[model samples]
Target chain A: MTDFAIDLKDVDKLYGGVFSRRVHALRGVDMRVGRGEIFGLLGPNGAGKSTLVKILMTVIRATRAMGTVLGRPVGNKPTLARVGYLPEHHRFPDYLTGRQVIEFYGAMSGVSRHERRKRAAELLDFVGMGKWADTRVRGYSKGMRQRVGIAQTLVNSPDLVIWDEPTDGVDPVGRRDIRQMTVELKRKGTTVMLNSHLLSELEMVCDRVAILVQGKVSSQGTIDELTVHRQRYEIEVSAGDSHVDAGVRKALAGWLPDGALEGRLEGGQTLKANFDSPHLPALITVSTADAQPVQPIIDALRNARLTVRAVKPIRPSLEDLFMEAVTDPVTGRTLAPGAKEGA
Target chain B: MVLRQTLAILGDAYRELNAKKMFWITLALSAFVVLAIACVGINSKGISVLWWTFPVDVFNTAIVSPALFYKLIFIGFGFKFWLTWAATILALISTASLIPDFVAGGSIDLMLSKPIARLRLFLTKYATGLLFVGLQVMVFSVASFLVIGIRGGVWDWKIFVAVPLVLLFFSYLYCVCVLIGIVTRSTIAALLLTVLFWFVLFLLHSGEQSLNLFKLNAEEQTATLEARAEPLSDQIAKSKAVIAQLSEAPTDETAEARGRREGELATKNASLTGLELRQQSTAKDLESYRASLGRLKLWHDVLFSVKTALPKTSETMELLQRVLTSSDETSKLEDAEQQRREERGTRRRDADAAKRDADNEADRGGPGFSPSVVRRQEEINRSRSVWWILGTSVAFEALVLAVACTIFVRRDF
Candidate 1:
């Protein structure tokens, strides 16, 4: 079997027929999620995040696809028995109770009656919905429904679970519960794929992530790999009434030569010396995550009797990676939000 | 796996119907209808409602048996009116939204993501929609079975056939509803268009039957005219021969005898002319009716072919009539009723009144009541075999469902 729970290659989805207005929802998207890992999919609104998840679940047919989900070709009916999906804005029948909803979906997934009954109860209590298990879903609040939606997804004990906006309409406590459940699923060797706009939540739980922009995957990798190049260290020196006191500038004169204040250091790392005029600290930024390179700058400030207030290492966040993926590099403006229209 | 999925959908459908107040309301109405059937009784004197007997001569128990009366009421009022018309309408209204709601955005996503195939999912849901009518008809048939047994004193097991018959009849229309629902995804459109389709079927059926009645009437008229013409033509030939014989005097005849022969010859000629006049009138009528018959047959055939290609809703329901009552029993009832009417006519009519009434009746439907218009209509309906009635209808339903399944399977929710 393939190591990935999902291995999609060159997937494309065109929404309408020739006579109608068409949308190119997904344009050659390639994505992968390794087994026993929590993978996050982040995108702007209408960027085809949901569309890709749907294609894997066989909810939408792709125009051109080459991939396997759980070691079977995409859209294979039998393969879905090992997969679970909680769609965005999923609506259960109002007539069914919470427990009935779970049991019904479990039965549909080919789970036997006794197992369905047992799992439904356990899952309901796990989601903290045991008190409302017998109540009809029509009377439940949105957060309650979301909890039930999550419970139903796990009824079959799927090997791969894809949840789109699992924490939508949920309170903070509920969101935490969902996160913990996702982690628990991963701990049990289940591959969890989550698509949500809550970047912080995904950042906390995801081992790897793919950022989609305008129907294409702009970046895909572990957080450390994606943020490695953008990681840096900031050295702030105390500024006098003149913003950057003469002592601070004189101390860093080697890194910032007279005519060129920003240049490469001896270690071949980018070093930019900032001397602000207003009442603020004069800063030195080293474009390397290694702490060895920043020790000399701090030593120079100290030997010159210049106050060295702080030296800190900064790593780009998932949100930062998300913003960079969606932004137009040439224009320095955010890219248009939606999938493009095509012939 | 398929069985489990199918049972899940069926269970969901039952729960959905259980939640709708209309389901319980319809069941209550059916009970009331059965109770109402139980309240009305046929007795030795006449029809009885509750404790009161309204004296009637023709429909008394002596003329109609309790078994036959109850069967008639069950087939006529219970099956035809309540189950076919009223209950079917309620079923359509309640279940019209089933397909549209099933394929709705969020709902369909959940269903389609399951391990089941799209075609199987769609078909199971479609069958589940019929659960509304199936349950309704089952309850109605069971109650009527009890009523017919207890009240009419005949525990006819055959009454249960109404359950499947009515369900089949409703399926013919429900298939159309499902097609429209899948296409438009609007409950109102599906319900209205399905009802309209049924009305068109009713109109076509009525048209075929009406044209057949006229065709039969015209054929009867032509036959009567031909029968009258034969004797009149013989009489005319005989009169002419006698006149010819009398016009020439015998050699031994006296003048007085010859003059008497002349008078007799004149009388024969006049009689022959009158007979010839009737022959001319009959020939004219024969031509008219023959022409009318040709026109009626053309239109009837046209309608018959059109109706043949469509589901036979009326004929499908009439299947119950065949299984419920024997032809012999109905014929006996009809003969008794006819004899009673004739006896009443004898008491009410003198010679003049009788002749006037006969002429009036002749003008009404052309010659001798057309010899059982009701029986002829029943014969036309009964001539339809089970295969033609249900097979063609099921073929039509299958065609419609095929189209619907294609849409449901191909559509992206």
Candidate 2:
């Protein structure tokens, strides 16, 4: 069995025929969304985020696609019963009440009427739309419509839920609630693929995220892994003289990994750890581009006859990674994937 | 499970149509219109358009059979041209947007994303659009039934045949609308094209009918010219033979032979000249008549083929007559009436023409009598079988739907 809720390889989608001006929406996209994880797809306006989500949801057809959803073949309708979708710019029938809209969609998903009613009530309240349940959607504000739209996405109780711009018109509190809801779904073992322009919202809740640039997966990994600068570590060495003993200095020289630090420790402060965390106060801070362990830094500080106040690792924010992934090197502030040059 | 989804989509479609205020308004107007038509009762005098009470005194209870009179009133108002037009156009325009709206991008995504098959969804949407026609006509038929019972004192439930018949007729045009709507995704464009299609069908049907009548007339004229020329050819041949025999006769002796030969030659010459003149005129008439027939035949062939290719639209609607009118008894009355009229000879006429005038006016939109006229209506309907008329129309609809569904399923949202 596949280890993913969705597994796609070499997926390509081109809008219009070859004779026309074809827009390549997705270019050889290979994606794996693991089971029971909240995966965010972050990208620009035409960056193929929505198109990718839609392909998984079977809302749009791919020109050349090979994949499976729910571990079955892609575009499988029976498997779609276990998948839910909320499209971007979705508009509900204006004549139906909010409750009716949910029930109607539930019915479309082959949910029993009684179950639809029960689920509608619970989901409407869950989305803070209980009061507006009986009101026609035409009179509801965009935020309210988004609330209903979200509630409807859960109507089928799908195992895999794909939401495109789920928090598009949502207010701040609603965005927070949506984030919380994503976490809750993850806890319940639901795999969610969230497509959103709200990078900050995604950063808060996403376990893993893939940044798409020009229809390609430029970078992808866990939030921590993507943002962390592993080579950089801060050793909080107190700025004092002779808090160190002679034996401790010798231990510091021996404890350091051979060639781990580029420069040697000398009588002054030459063989110190170079990188540090940005959140800490004035102390000894060490930074390096090399990937290494943190234990050595702790050991070195302990040997230096000074208290290791804090040994911290520094990392970039999600925005910094996103900018670095999407922007051109020459015209952009970010130097490269691993560069900390701008910061 | 497909059934449930079908029902779900069908239910949603129902709700979509039900949400329109125009549907209800049209229903109300139909009810009012039908009940208002039921108010009048016909008699020998004339129709009472807005009858509030039974004016039994104004009607003459004698002359025609009361049952025949009441049936005339029922059929005349119910099947009149104006009512058919109004019902058809109103029901069509109101339900025009159902398909376009269902296939609208966001809305269609919700449906197509379901486990339901796309073709089934499409078909159910079609059935849903048809539901409008079904409901509208059923209501109208029932009201007409009640009216016929209450006013005409004719409680024939068969009047309800109009329900399916009208639905079938309206579908002929509505199918074109649906096909256009799928291609264009515009409600106004669909409705306009459907109307235009109906106009073209009307022109073609009328053109065929008129051309057929002209062909029949030309054939009759040609036959008459051929019969008139036959005897003239015989007379010309007899005259030429006699003229030859006289020229061959040997000359006898003296004044008696000369005088007799001169008289004989003069008489034969006059007779030959007159026969030749009549024969020439007759031949020219035959040529003119045959030429007319040839032209009519050319047009007739073109129209007949065009008519055959199209669905039998008017005939499909006309199928209502088989159930609406009394067939057997009406046919006997018509046969006897026609026999009697034929016996009245060339110069003198009968009351049949006057009665026919009154019947035509009533059928146009009023009230009068004739069990005989029902035979012609029945004959026109029976020319095509139930299967032939309805089957061809449904085939047209199916072809269009197939094309639409193909476009719908293949195109990416």
Model 1, A112-191: lDDT tens per residue?
Answer: 99999999999999999999999999999999999999999999999999999999999999999999999899999999
Question: What Cα-based lDDT does every candidate model obtain?
Answer: 0.90, 0.72
Q: Flag clash pairs in model 1.
A: none
What shift in Å separates residue B130 of candidate 1 from its native position after superposition?
Answer: 1.9
Model 1 CAPRI quality: medium
Poorest 10 consecutive residues of model 1 chain B by lDDT?
B362-371
* DockQ of candidate 2 relative to the true structure: 0.54
Residues B223-260 of candidate 2 have per-residue lDDT tens digits of 77788788878877887788787666575546777678
Model 2 residue B357 lDDT score: 57
Instruction: Find the 10 residues in a row with the least total lDDT in model 1 chain A.
Output: A239-248
Best by lDDT: 1
* Residue B283, model 1: Cα distance from true site in angstroms: 3.4
Task: Kindly report the root-mean-square deviation of model 1 from the true structure over all alpha carbons.
Answer: 2.9
